[model samples]
Target: MLVLGIESSCDETGIALYCTRRGLLAHALHTQMAMHAEYGGVVPELASRDHIRRLVPLTQSCLKDAGADFADIDAVAYTQGPGLGGALLAGASYANALAFALDKPVLPLHHLEGHLLSPLLTDEGVDFPFVALLVSGGHTQFMAVHGVGDYVLLGETVDDAAGEAFDKTAKLLGLPYPGGAKLSELAELGTPDAYRFPRPMLHSGDLNMSFSGLKTAVLTAVEKARAEHGGSLPESVRNDICRAFQDAVADVLAAKAAAALRQTGLRTLVVAGGVGANRQLRQRLCALTIGKEAVQTFFPPPALCTDNGAMMAFAGAMRLRHGVQAAAPAGAFTVRPRWPLAQLSP
Candidate 1:
C-alpha cells in the first residue's frame, strides 16, 4: 500500500510518502525554527501560515523524489491532534481534501503514536511488547507498548517535560531561542563537577517524574554564578551549568526508564521524540541495564526524532498493515488539538 503522511503539529511542516512493500519512498520537511527564533519561541499564527505555504510544495517535492504521482497514493495519513489547533487543522484539512480528491481513505493518526512507533521504521529487531520513553519539547512520558494502537501510559512528567526544561534552562543561561540543542552543544565542553543540580522525583517510588524543580534549581545556580561574576556569567561557567543540567536530566530519564522496564519485565526500550536525539541521553540509555540483563534501546534516526512526515507516514502505513480502519473521505472533518494518546483504540 502507498500512504502519504502530513505532519504540521507545530513549528515544522513535514510531508512524506511511504510504501508497505518498499518502505519510506521519500520525505520533505520545512522547519520554522529560524523564523520562530526571532520571536524567542513559536508564534502559532506564523507556524500555521507557514504550514499552508509549505505543504503543497513539500508534497510535490516528496512525490518527485519518490518518482510517484498523486494518483499512486493508496491512502492519506495525517496528524490529527495533540498540537496547535491551527497547525493540526492545516494538515488535517489538506489531508482530508486530498484524500477526498483521490477517493482514498484517510488515516488520522495520533501525534504521539507517530513518535512511539518511529523506531520501527528503521530497526527491524525491535518487536512488540516494549517500553517506550517519549521525551519531547511538549511531553515526556513512559508507555508500555503491546502492539500497534495498544499503548498503556506508564508514567509522565508532573510538570515541565525534559526538553522544555532544557530550553528554559538554556534561556536562563543567555542562550538563544530553541535553546535545548545549543545547550547540549555547550555541555560537551563543560566540566562534569563544576556544578550540581537536583534530580526531581528520582526516588518517588513510581514512574512519574518532574523537571520543574530542576529548572528552578538551575535558575538559583545561575543567579549565584551571575552574582559572583559581577552580573555576567562566564562562558566556562555557563558550559558547566549546561553539563550539570544535561547530566541531571539524563540521570532522571535513565533511572525512570530502567524502573519502567523492571516494573513491566520488558527489556526492550524504544526512545523517541526530540530529546531522544540528545547525545548524552543516548549514551546513557545505550549503556543502561536492569539487574543482570542488558536492555535493548532503539532510537529513530536523528532526523526523525523531531516532528516529521516520515514518522507519520510510517506510522500510518503500520496501522493500515495492522488492520486499523481508515475513515472514508468526507467533506467535513474536525481536529483534536488535545487528544490523549491513551484514548486511542485498537
Candidate 2:
C-alpha cells in the first residue's frame, strides 16, 4: 500500500509518498521559515495562504520524485490538528478534496502521533514501548509510547516550550528572528562557566516543566549585563549568556529524560520536534547513550526533526501496515487543534 501524506500545520508545507513495501519513496517540502522569520514568529493567516498555494505543486513534485502517478497512491493521509486551525484546514481541505476525487481512503492523523512515530522511520530496529521527549516550537512533553496510538502522558511544560524560550531569548539579545538555531550556534563559542542559568522544576518529582521563568531569568540577566557593560550587552557576554541558557535547558531535559527512562524502565529514548535539532542537546544525549548500561537514544535527522509531511506519511504507512484504520471518513471528520496524544485510541 502507498500513502500520500500532507502536512501544513504551521510554517511548512510538506508532501510525501510512503510505500508499505519499500518505505519512504519521495517527499517535497516548502518552508515559510524565512517569511515568518521577519515577524519573529508565524502569522497563521499567511501560513494558511501559503499552504493553499503550495499543496498541489508539492504533491505533484512528490509524486514525480517517486516516479508514480496520482492514481498509484492507495490512500491519502493528512495532519488533522494540534496546530493552527487555518493551517490544519488548508491541509485537511486539500487532502480531502484530493481523496474525494481519487476515491482513496483519507487518514486524518494526529500531528503528535506523527512526531512520536517519526523515530521508527530512522531506526527500523526500534520496537514499541519507549520514552519520548517531544520538544518543538509549540510543545514540550514527555510521553511513554507503548505502540501505535498507545501513548501515555508522562509530563509536559506548564508554560513556554524549550524552543520558544530559545527564540525569545535570542530576540531579546538582538539575534535574528526564529533564533533557536542561531542561539545554539552562538552558544558553542561561549565558555560554559562564564554564566549560569536556572533549571526550572528539576526537582518537582514529576515530568511537568516550566521554561517561562527561565526566559525571564535570562531577561533579568541580560538587563544586568547591559547595565554593567555601559548600556549594551557585549558580544562575549551575550554569547556566554546564550551558552548558560542552552546548558540550563539541556541540563533539565537530560535530567527529565533520564528520569522518564528510569521510571518506564525503557532503555530506548526517542527525541523529536524542532528543539531536538540543537547540537548541545544532541551532545548531552550522546553522552548519556555512551555507557555500557541498557539505555539508547534516537533522534530524527535534522530535516525530520521539524514538522513535515514525511512523518505523517511514514506514520500512516505504519498504521496501514499494522492494520490501524481511522474510524471515520471524510464526511464524518473532525479536527482536534488541542487534542491530547494520550487520548488517542490504540
Candidate 3:
C-alpha cells in the first residue's frame, strides 16, 4: 500500500510518501522556526497560512523524489489534532481534499502516536510491549505500549512540559526565540555542578512529573546571578546555569524512565519527540539500568526527532498493515486540535 502523510500540527509543514513494501520513499519538510523566531513564538495565523502555501509544493517535491505520482497513492494519512487548531485544519483540509480527488481512503492519525511510533522507522529493531518516553515542546509523558494503537498512560507532567521549561528558562536567560535547542548547545560548554537546579517531583512516588517549579527555580537563580553581576549575566555563568538545568532534567527523566521500566518489567525504552534529541537526555537514557538488567533505548534519527511527515507516513502504514480501518471517504472531515493519545481505540 502507498500512503501519503501530511503533518502540519504546528510550526512545521511536512509531507511524505510511504510504501508498505519499500518503507519511506521520500519526505519533505519546511519549518517556520525562522519566521516564528521574529515574533518570539509561533503565530497560529501565520503558521496556518504557511502550511497552506507549502503543502502542495512539498507534496510535489516528495513525489518527485520518490519517483511516484499522486495517482499512485492508495491512502492518505494526516495529523488530525492535538495542536494549533488552524495548523491542524490546514493539513486536514488539504489531506482530505487530495484524498477525495484521488478516491483514496484517509487515515486520521494522532500526532503523539506518530511520534511514539517513529523509532520503528529506523532499522534498530524496536519492538512492541515497551515503555515510551514522549517528550516534546508541547507534551511530556510516559506510556506503556503493548502494540499498535494499544497505549496506556504511565505518567505525565502536571504543568509545563520539559521542552517548554527549557525554552522558558532560556528566554529568562536572554536567549532568542525557540531557545530550547540553543540552551542545549550552550549546556555543552557549561561546568557541571556550578549552579544546580531543583528537580521537581523527583521523589513524589509516582510517575507524574512537574517542571514549572524547576522553571521558577531557574528564574530565582538567574535573578540572583544578575543581581551579583551588576544587572548583567556573564556568558560563563549562563552556560553553567544551562548545564545545571539540563542536568536536572536529564537526571529526573532518567530516574523516572528506569522506574517505568521496572514497574512494567520492560527493558525496551523508546524515546520520541523533539527533546529525545537532547544530548544529555540521550546520554542518561542510553546508560539507564534497572537493577541488574540494562535497558535498551531507541531514538529516531536526528532529522526525524522533530515533527515530520515520515513518522506520520510510517505510522499510518503500520496501522493499515495491522488492519486498522481507514476513513470511508474524504467527503466531510474535521480536525481535533486537542485530541488525547489515550483516546485512540485499539
TM-score to native of every candidate shown: 0.99, 0.97, 0.99
Q: Lowest lDDT 10-mer window, candidate 2?
A: 325-334
- Cα lDDT of model 1 overall? 0.93
Show pairs that collide, candidate 1: none
lDDT, candidate 2, residue 79?
Answer: 94
Please report, in order, the local distance difference test score of every candidate based on alpha carbons.
Answer: 0.93, 0.88, 0.93
TM-score for predicted model 2 compared with the true structure: 0.97
- Per-residue lDDT, model 3, residue 342, is 85
In candidate 2, what are the lDDT values of residues 130-190, reduced to their tens digit? 8999999889999998888778999999999999988998898889888888999999999
Clashing residue pairs in candidate 3 (N, C-alpha, C atoms within 3 angstroms): none
Clashing pairs in 2: none
Question: Candidate 2 at residue 33, lDDT?
Answer: 86
**Candidate 2 steric clashes:** 0
Shift in Å, residue 90, candidate 2: 0.4
